[model samples]
Target: METLSNLECFARAAATGSFSSAAKQLGLTPSAVSRNVAMLERNLAVRLFHRTTRKLTLTEAGERLADSIRSNLEGLQDAIAEASDQQQEPSGVLKVSMASVFGMDYVLPLLPGFLTAYPKIRIDWQLDNRHVDLVAEGYDAAIGRGSELTPGTISRTLARVRIVAVASPAYMKARRPPASPQDLAGLDLIDMRSTRTGRLVQWMLRDEHGNEAVSPVGERIIFDDPGGLCKAAALGLGAAFVATSHALPYLQRGELIQLLPDWSADGGPISIYYANRRYLPPKTRVFVDYVADAFRDQDLAGRF
Candidate 1:
């Protein structure tokens, strides 16, 4: 047990590059973490760290040990957790990342039920519109549009995200409702600026028969956020292309109306991503299943 504790302290310090940072993560004082690492070095009879006031660097032996244990340590911890009280119920902080609007609208609503079911689990939900390196960033899970999968991570499809053209009733009333996507070229168009890239996103619309076409953007009013784009369209600014998840509430309230409903763009699946492990943590496992079930129950896949 002492050896395991020392290994954890050493691994954390190696990964974080500071005793203070490791202490913060492990709920120990800096001196305690430092002592643990020192004890580990003495037990192994190997110099592990090149320490200075400003920085901590691993020695050759330390780097080798860190590399060897990096993957195995989590599995050992999971094994330990599985044998502990966590086996009875899911517990610990489930760190999740999701888009702001979608998280608030969809996943956030499930929190009450989730908490009621697993009272010991704590939520560390971060809402942002960025592609995150799940393992590197220490995120237990992420929910958003599909991206290139990380090597040690896997994605579970929650819903097929569909992008549709929408406009306020007043905006459509003033202009002819687009019979085809080409008609959008003549009207004022709200555009979504790519959050990752500085360029305006071109809308590629597909019909029921699997035919596809690109809609031109006027670039009159551009927003980085889908919610903002929907809001702009609702204010009678122009027709905008946005995901169904972002447009659903507005459409329900009569704030926005779908145009050329037969034509929509494939925005890719909304997936919940997590580490691919031999033994998935109970907290993460339950959270993923809960969210998947919620989406299934609501028929979001069919709707979006």
Candidate 2:
């Protein structure tokens, strides 16, 4: 019988198409990964991969075995997770991924309380704006903005985030505020490049009759970081459209003013997503519950 370690190495190498990448995924040295695959090949009396300096291609037999190994490993993982879920207190590293801004604004603040409540579990939180592959990256859970979730992931609505168009009071004093989404076209738009698609992001707004329209603005300053854009807007550089939560502090201090109250962009739902919901570790379950309860009363618009 092939050892589970050997099978894991072979499966990861085949899946990643590189021994080095597989090694990294498995937390093994590249040479160790190579040796494991070699052992598996010897045991099966077949070549598993055609390796060259730049790439690896799986053999026909290797491809077939890889599929079986992957399925079996996933099943075993699911079974182990199910067993672990039955424990009175979950104790394991819980990995979470989220956008940088949301993690900083909402999730990070709650960590101390969560850690104190559940002392057994450890946390590895990653914050990045780019989309993450939860399964491939080995994340246990993710909190993301927007409605669309990655396929095969379980999603729950954490909150509904509202977006608002805002400009510093100083900027509004120099230029008239945009009365409607359409008026945004003529303004000096401070564009967060990370959020902008192509030339601009469509500002979705609804009128009194519930008619919706998207207005694209001309970009005056394209900033990659949301914080930088917020700062620039606060300094009266240009008008900015940001999630209401992000602009809340500035609004309270009177550094920025909402441009158009009646017209605003709809941010879909702020959601907490996981690869699987059934048999979740107690720590993850408790944390999710805590976040849901914490934000329950506060309207999404007031969360920032």
Per candidate, the number of residue pairs that clash is 0, 0
What is the TM-score of each predicted model, taking all chains together? 0.84, 0.85
User: Which portions of model 2 miss their true places by more than 4 Å?
Assistant: 195-199, 281-286, 297-304
Report RMSD (Å) for each prediction in the order shown. Answer: 3.0, 2.9
Which candidate achieves the best lDDT against the true structure? 1
List where candidate 1 sits over 4 angstroms from the true fold: 13-25, 29-61, 85-87
For candidate 2, give the lDDT of residue 302.
56
lDDT of 1 by residue, 113-213 (tens): 99999999998999988888675566889998858897779999998888999999998786767788889898888888877678898867889998889
Residue 269, candidate 1: alpha-carbon lDDT: 87
